[model samples]
Target: MLTGALSSRMSSSVSSSDRIFPPSSFGSFESPGIRASSCFSGPNADMNEYDETDLFSISWNQDYGCFAAGTSHGFHIYNCEPFKEIFRRELKNGGFKFVEMLFRCNILALVGAAANSSYPPNKVLIWDDHQSRSIAEFTFRSEVHGVKLRRDGIVIVLKHKIYVYNFMDLKLLHQIETLANPRGLCCLSHHSNTFVLACPGLHKGQVRVEHFGLNVTKLINAHDSQIACFMLTMDGLLLATASVKGTLIRIFNTMDGSRLQEVRRGVNRAEINSIALSPNVQWLAASSDKGTVHIFSLKVRVSGLDSITHPNSPQGPALFHQNSSTSIDPLVSPNTGANPNSLLSFMRGILRKYFSSEWSFAQLHLPGNTQFIVAFGSLNSVMIVGMDGSFYKCSFDPVHGGEMVQQEYVRFLR
Candidate 1:
């Protein structure tokens, strides 16, 4: 590792019993609007604010093969495919508020919880699990909002600024200024051939896209309200964003700021917990506080866009405009999970976009009043991780889009 430490230390390992219970049924429900910051828990809350059984944080690895959960004790890692606990560190002196794994490797970016005196929140600790100690550390004047990791670089997110560094020598490469981002919202492309980074821009509802391969930066005004959550495809070519309004989810082309498609989650405002795109980019899954997970079919394809224009063309990005008349078909209704259309086709233009916008093709309903994040799993199934310590794997129908069948359920934490 970076510290050149090869010696290992003995640490306590906690064993967890995995219980496989019968699949449980779910139903949908809706409530009032939730503030965009509810999921982030604001800047003041700490590990002491939660009960001993409650999780301080939960996040998936870069490829979603596994996830890390931080608790009052320490942090635990779980495998997604076999649904087993890989390993855990029960540190008696400290707890982690953020434990980000680097694609199932031994290296992790850790930010300690407020109650952890040994490791403070303002410091980023690069822990090498093989050594059972921190190899490299970065201390800042202010609390860190988040951290992103890649094979070649490390990104540190602060309230108003983001710092990028090379992984080999830990050399500072670039820094960016952003709005008041308490959540430390940032995403990076996982593909090794290209480098793309997305984060909040300097203005409200704007997203800054840095395409390192193309040597270009594009700013997209994604929404009118504040951005709630967004996700970039593994290739970093497509970006899906949701606003605080939570009514519409828009997809954008990272090469040039252009809206590719717009899908409606609901007419009412809600807090979106997470969004996921299939590996093929043909399906998208989103979860909100309304206790529902919606999946939408994507019409755009990568090959189709590449045929339109060269990536370096000076004219404009070769893609279909979101509002282009040719992009819409009035004759056929949209493929969605919502009720059948009631309005006449001629009256669509007179009504709000909600009346004519595309909706999810399939849905999986869970209980409301809890936070959840979704990811596409193998064999047309979706894996959902909730803050309530619930984990589920449900399968959806690709041909007949409707309600999903719950395949397996487990409580990862006791």
Candidate 2:
């Protein structure tokens, strides 16, 4: 076990939960185009350059075309088009614990940590930054891990349960049961009444889903191994799940709860930190403890890109949604793992606690390491940010040969 002092000494300057994604893809580098910036390279905004000593958190608002950042100093918002700062609020208080924005609006949910007096650790304040104070606050007895906001309501996740509250009045609407989850793996449909929540299930290798609008609970017997990570699309139309094995990644249809396709992440067991879908739900990106980031094409079925490719190369979209009927045919069942009764399978189960290697289709090896968050900047471009405050923007041309070019980079902390 890592001692507290040693763990603190080895910890990264930033953690995955503190990073943010660009609201949309920036492939063209034209509209919300970000050219190489000398902002942090030279005279910076307010001379507030990022250093390892600061605790920072960030998020991007596509609707507002801006990004919000929280630091030990204070919280601020910046525009993407011109790559300039719009405003920064100075607060030496724990700055902000978990900060979330609503479509570039003045509405933000602020969770305070040790330093902030405006709110407590268990309280979530519906912040009206226009007024620079909280208009509504919800208090709980337990420490809040994270807070998620949707148009209809807000979801607050605890270690064992989840609560959904109405946005207009902050009234409790639904309470859900989950496993011991510290990260709050909940994703709400951006435009619909649906939301997906995963918690520990009836047994090992199982996951529990609480669907709000549909009024149903789904138990996906997805893997023989324990579930590692899962994510829902913005529209809640699909779900991507990975197991502890880290050898297979499966996509599901939320409407009927059917496995649509399965793709191999690798044959080895690795710790996966994050999985995210593109704005169009056509691309799926993931990152793990291996110090390698992977982007998988979801435009086609997982049986193989053979059907949708240009018929010359084995690269293109994995048309999961388009040819749904054919994609689910029994003959093309993707071999995710070995037979349940195989001797090798039994051996793997016993040896899983040790380390193993996993492979990704479109992988970019990072120069340094920590858990990272993966997001699509544009259809052809991806952004990878390490918990240690390392940032990278890489663009790849998958059709010809998936070669990633580091387009831009910046270190948030020295």
Candidate 3:
């Protein structure tokens, strides 16, 4: 049996005055469960003040040590390492509500409601960090609810379909239609070119997995209530689903739709608004409405095999009736042989029953209820977007922490 280490760490230091500011105490921890302050003192410090209600989404840029956030008013880009705003942009229509940054490029896909309307816009703008200009604008008719950019530049989870586009050219390549209205969509490329899609149904709250252009392989009744978010491992082996009713996260196998584990959290009954997986697929972190983020470690083990021979074969010489005209009989014993693999499987099941245990949960403060989280950096640091339009950077340590730790701190300014 394989076991993972668990440890909790809180932020090191924060002033009483600064503690009131949620974003100031972000990175004061060396382990899990750390609560740090969110403070910024740099060129864009003046932009740090924002209305608590206007924040929508946040993202971190690993290459530049910066973070970008979207709000009702527009978007703000900040320096994570220095805790300062490098640039700020106010949209013309005041509806730049959602923002997602590409992992490999400085490109940002911004989505939000259109002017004078309660609903979001049909088009999305892609902005380049270097020029700070809208490089490409994509138009959709049904309203763009969510958008995710892969390394190859595929955007997923549109209003009622999935769209794959060229990252460099923003050219449409393929589309997958859905039976139910999709709340969210996740994709994992298994063999570089082929990928699996996980889509959450809005009405049924069910989850489905299918290969690109292939038939659905796995389907499960995922949540009782609406599914707020879902995530898939990079290798497309595991799936995690979270609901709005409770802090219960269920993980499933991608191959046969087997329930691998269930994680129940004792924190507030907040909707799991966002989820992110580490690059190595060892850790999973989720942000909820309770103003906290929870992290869990995933461990996988394969079983061993056994070998055995049949015991029912005639082992010794038996007296036959052919020797004499008199009555003679042949005796036989009941067969007790079993398939070696079957026996090995039964033993392995017993071993798992004795050694395997349910997964544990650890809570970490993310300053506030976050709408989104993205894993960036070559080290795969966590970046969360608070509902108040603040951005934070969190990392994990495999040794003493709960698989992942919040190693540093950075707060985004307006």
Best by lDDT: 1
Candidate 3 Cα deviation (angstroms), residue 382 = 5.1
At residue 218, give the lDDT of candidate 1.
92
Cα error, residue 55 of model 2, in Å, equals 3.0
Show the colliding residue pairs in model 1: none
Tens digits of per-residue lDDT for model 3, 213-256: 34445676787776667877554556788776756787776666
Give the range where candidate 1 is weakest over 10 consecutive residues by summed lDDT. 18-27
Against the hidden reference, what TM-scores do the models get?
A: 0.79, 0.69, 0.60
Ranking by TM-score: 1, 2, 3
lDDT of 2: 0.58
Give one digit per residue, the lDDT tens place, for model 1 in 1-414: 021211112221111211111111101322122111101111222233234554888889988889999876677889989788887665545678999999988899888888876667777767766655554566677788898999888888989988887776556778888888997889888778667899999999999999776778999999999888999887677889999888899888787787877789999999998989887677899999999999997755333233333545454322223322121111111222332443444688888768766788999999747899999999889999998999999999999989999998999878
Worst 10-residue lDDT window for candidate 3 reads 1-10
Model 2 stretches with alpha carbons more than 4 Å out: 1-52, 56-69, 76-87, 115-118, 193-204, 299-359
Please give the lDDT score at residue 130 for candidate 3: 53
Please identify which of the two predictions, 1 or 2, would achieve the higher TM-score against the true structure: 1
Predictions: Cα RMSD each: 13.7, 12.9, 19.3
